[model samples]
Target chain A: MPRQRPPAIRIALCLAALAAGLLPWWNAREMAKSAFPGFEVTAPSAGESGEPAFFKKTVVNPFSPHKKSHSASLVRMEDGRMFAAWYAGSGECAPDVAVYLASTDAAGNWQAPRAIFNREKAMADLGRNVISVGNALLLADGNRLGLLFVTVAAGRWSGSSMNIAWSDDAGMTWSRAQNLTMNPLANLSALPRNPASPLAGGGWAVPVYEEFLGKFPEVLWLLPRGGGYDFAVSRVAGGVSVMQAALVPLSRTDAVCLMRDFRPAQFMSISSTADAGRTWTPPQATELPNKDSGICGARLPDGSILAAYNDRSTGKRENLRLAVSGDGGKTWKRVATLEEEPGFEFSYPSMVCDPDGTVRMLYSARQTQIVYVEFNTAWLKEQEVLQ
Target chain B: MSTLTVFLLVVWFFQRVLPVRGLLGLGVSTAAGAAFVFIPWLGFWIKSLAPNASIPMVGLLLAAILGRACNKSVFRPADWKAAWIFGAAASLMLYPSALGLGAFDTYSLGWPWLFHSVSIALFAGVGVASAVLLWLGNRFGYLLLLAGLGYLAGFQESTNFWDYVLDPLFGAVSLVALIAMAWRSRNPRPANPRGTTAP
Candidate 1:
């Protein structure tokens, strides 16, 4: 009962349809041509291999800071200058919270940390209603200092997203913020805790986590593209219980991820990748205890791993300890106790190894101050013998 | 791209708010879109609802609604129904795993086409679906084609292919409408004595 459309029009439509279908496939094929050339891992070289150096100090803001501070991260710049960042406010997820940054001067004195970003700045830059800001991580990309932090828009931690900003003049001034579209649905729940590790091609493998629907660890790859960077995310493992991964690249083709355990197991989980981060073994529990708190790790010049985490099985973040692993994180031996007071909290430890074999550590002290600790393999060797 | 989506969505909202009778209403809609961007909290609320939704989806819906409000039929009811069914299916295939119901994340497969074969398969599936829609003479097929081009141009903040094709809000609406349509089909209104249904 209906007159048919012309066959010529249908033919034209089909040809156009074929082109449309091929366009995305063509784009995808072109994109796949530039596969990641593996991580450009730089294990600490044996520069001054046997140097016996040990240093410890607490870098705090001279002015009156916020009531609470947590998630401290440290990065060594190209000029060998050390910079630190952490978020502080009335409480976690509080509207008053702001990300703060500090750098050590030539005289080795830590300058007062100044507020680098906050909810108001986020609201203004993002043109959205931001509820709070938290979990700031500092990354060194050549001479540029990059800060990745979390901004909550509507709800609690579940309603959060990640934003990145760069400072070219060593944290004196920062560029405008750009949101990382980690999720398309309201861009919810992507948080960065640990600083990134150097990849093979002058790129960075930043460790971040998701906490909204499920808790899991993911790696955000910032591969150099022309003069800027291309972003990609690879899931370390799939689960609802492990998150806040600390990625430590052991070689160009090998890395281990340390994850915070949110399950009843209460032990830190470990996953390894033999081909950069393209694929990972499902996380298995390590002997190290983790009570849903943050952890960090770095590779020493001796091919050893030094990890800092809240070492407890009873689910209290009152004790922070250092552990050394020679078997690629399969086992760990406690070397030093950095903080131990049952009534107080000292958690969220972030560690990084300097080129000259100096291990710098940072963590929240009593949830009120950011504490910095430095040591060397000489100190670690001594602690190992003592243990 | 985000700013563009915000502008388009705001224009659609303005049409609803003003609801003037003809093509003249679009002038009012443009004025409202320009003013709302500077109005601060209003823009944020809209973005907070669906921040990273596909641009073509929003743009197409806006065009359809405006055409009707201006007494110009750009899309028939069948075109919208087809789009709803397509979008709802895509969402179901993604959100369950993305929300952590399974061990694998469907969302991560959208990062690029190299690491996962699933992405290529999904892309090819979309291509086939586009061809089928075009063959059926549905205008929603054009939307699908535009989404593919937009994806190639990186028209959205997200590089994931799924983000350019489907979003949670659109998926939710499509799913609800499909369910209602199914329910109504199962229980048709009784025919009037004059062989017409009551209004």
Candidate 2:
């Protein structure tokens, strides 16, 4: 008879094999309960006069024009307090870049910018040598706040990964950062741009993008876990020419994603999902012009889709405008021009509609500071009338 | 990065980058751990190589190197050939679609609840493969078990099961090894010397 292995080794290998098979299946079962049953637009009651009630634009971080500031995101807490976050440093890919957070008082006064995350903090949290930080995205889950930002350890932005940290008592304190494993290849190239939409069950439908060998839009489904949350990445649409998806929830089981186009002279790419985020239609070009810049979209109180992006057709990011879509995101009309300097840059606009029917917008102004804007439906209507 | 992954990176630095090769398995591992704690630049260099590696792949390489150094090796030449074949096959199936070469992405199957049919099939395949490998007492069976356990334990940041099993580095090395093996088989050396005939 052939020599056989020891019975104990055989039994141990069998047990390990059983464990290897059973564990991922158990995790899969647990993850199956995390449903992305689409998102719902939760706008406040809408009845306002067209007399332009409140319209204000202010810089969130002023003075320090030498330092670069870009990609600001906004979130309104359950107590009606608003917070804004953006990354600022020497330059775009400089190692000194850090994510800054600023909160507004009840009276709408913006606080000074504070560095919440940086390269050293990322190195400590991730046990890796981070090269830089970019694109701070803030989302509010009831009272607690979640901030998802980008960290680059090697290569360029394509070599970045998304790290998330939560603050229970607003933006004062935060949990240690946890990296979201997005890619199988080196876990590279997952970046966040716009704010997240609240899912039906108890999660956030965050729109992130991949930038490794190709640029594509992906939706990060975040389900609440103990202090932080468990996350899964779902591709919104796969292509090499579109990224930075801004999600606008149309119904409880439907949503539309608007993405930035990397192809030159191309319009904004749009895709729709009917069965939550399980599947999406092929992305197609929209009517709005995109010069490879970040854009944000939100469903307005009056059942209109509002998208903010650089209005230039084929050139620089000098002009930024807000366009409203009546029939979903099929067609758009430019209602207001937020920034229109010929040579200066005013791009990467992030917008959110507050609970009290107030519309807030934030964008990078001249790459020097983040400009904050607040308005009402009445003011938006007035702009439409003027147009 | 996991603690084990950090330790493995340091071990990799010592095994592949350093000039010292006369140490035992335990000695190398201990010195690598000490260097990681006492030295900062060494940690930075090791972590800088992270974007090209995965935890399980690092563990596998370290295990083989340590087994050889300890003189209690678990893998034979045939076992390494099996590992190379598995790595090469997995890389060929995953990389092209994952890098966006096709309409359907193979990487999406790694995520849960997104592709129901594909995920189910993949799970069943893994279960069956695990059973067969364990039945035959293959050393790669242990590697698969460790990868599965590490993925389930959430040892690393990656949620993908494939990230715990294979990376581009392992795939590339396996492909190169397979090609070399094929070339060697095709062009074998003669047993007799140039001026003498076989007795």
Candidate 3:
């Protein structure tokens, strides 16, 4: 027979196991608390009426430079200036494809778009022949602006890899590119479409998706590491085939993602993460109709979620609509129509709420130009009344 | 021709020259290399049919040369058993998790800290195993060493470690071999019951 250990040793071993189990749980809870703080949702008052006002501007000319241009992203700089980026070339994934950047002055006049990065520059910097480059996302981290994009290595999208270039001078100059190595296969097909949402714990969560062999949606946490940012990836565990997720935080530890489903679900898929996007619940279909196109969202000042998407299931790429959720995306009310016209394509929407409660939305108009629009709660309320 | 194809052909020719010791091996190796290189349709067909299927030229060459010199097969029964075990274990671990049927996403282990640690441990384990096999006079040790070296040198276009170790073709072959072995073992042919009574 084996000898029995002392009570103290047994107690120690039990305590060790208990600690090992509870420590990660405690850490995750604390991280979630710091990352997302709960916000009170104030419902919009009824019967309010006023003359709604908004400003609209075109950021780029699609016909002069490139035949096709899309996937536009916008970021507000530290200097109170707005910046936007998109890819343009003969077509998507073409060798001549390049990323273009534009900025608006303090007077809100849009600047001419210029080529920021192209295939030749990327190839030269990486010391390899880059087949194509696209999916340009601009993220503002304090004083630095981080540009994330994808490069096809072996002349195929399945061989795609991600690269990052930072600009400290606010889009004036950029540093050389560095490989963002997440997958061993170098096949991180997911690209960040919307700007990253900042966490209270000195990090930001960016939504990305993978569509190589299958559709796998994931959240990438960009934390400050040394002088630059490093990524910690967590899969969004939805059994559905979803991609290009738009994340909306509901509380300090909880957030919801609206994803684009590739399959003919005809509805925007929804998934929630309670631990600051470390993991997510399985995705399910939502009430909002989607046409297998990219959508974007941002939290309003009054703690409401605002989403912009093409609001039809089986129609032409027309009628871009805005929806508002007061109960943290549990229920949404279609508040306004931004664009509605036949024989036109309006998709890939990105939204941002300014300090003065102004909602700035930038989206591609017919794959020809980047359209920027500004409005507020009053405008949404007025439109709601009109409907 | 791609640089990789050219490089592989040159290595194959050099390996053949050592064992055959004549112009015949050189000519044959050269012809094979030329076919793989100059024929665009052949390359495209191979890629389409079996995406990651490139012959393990170094391993085959080493096996052939050693078999010729020693007048015996380079791969022993024990070597085949090892290959089967490696293949089965890899497929079991990779396929299900890759398909998202499992709880843990094993592909995420490709990230740096975990990736580096696992790769280093695998290399060390293979080193010890190969050393033991070589000490026991098995040429399969050379094959394992060559594979490890090829992975480290980025011999293939892929950066994935799994692609270096086993592709779909290798996995299927090993699985079939294991099944056949199991069947033979379980249903052994009856011995000549009437000893020496048959014609």
Number of the predicted model whose lDDT against the real structure is largest: 1
Off by over 4 Å in 1: A1-25, A28-34, A43-48, B1-39, B63-73, B113-117, B197-199
lDDT of 2 by residue, A1-387 (tens): 123479887777777777675567656665575566667666434546444567999988876544789889999887878899999999886998999999988897898889999899888886777899998899888888889998887888987888888888877788888877776676778888988998876789899888889778888888766755667777777669888999988777777898899787568888888888778888889889888888998887766778998866625698888898888788889898888887789989999875455789999888888999998877877887887
Q: Kindly report the docking quality category of candidate 2.
A: acceptable
Encode model 3's per-residue lDDT on A1-387: one tens digit a residue: 123357675444444333322232332332333322232222333322343565455655544467878888888877778888888889878999899888887887778888888988987665545778888888887677889888776646656667788998878889998766444333345566776677664657778766666666666666655666556455776334778888877567678888887677778777887765655777788788887888888777677778888888536468788888887777888988888888788989988776455788788887868888888777777788876
Q: How does chain B score by TM in each prediction? A: 0.83, 0.76, 0.62
Give the runs in model 2 whose Cα sits over 4 Å from its true position.
A1-19, A43-54, A355-357, B1-38, B48-59, B70-73, B101-108, B111-117, B188-199
Quote the lDDT for A24 in model 1. Answer: 62
Per-candidate interface DockQ score: 0.46, 0.43, 0.06
Reference-based lDDT, each prediction? 0.79, 0.77, 0.64
Worst 10 residues of 3 chain A by lDDT: A35-44
* Order of candidate numbers by TM-score, starting with the best: 1, 2, 3
For the predicted complex of model 1, DockQ is 0.46
Error of 1 at A18 (Å): 4.3
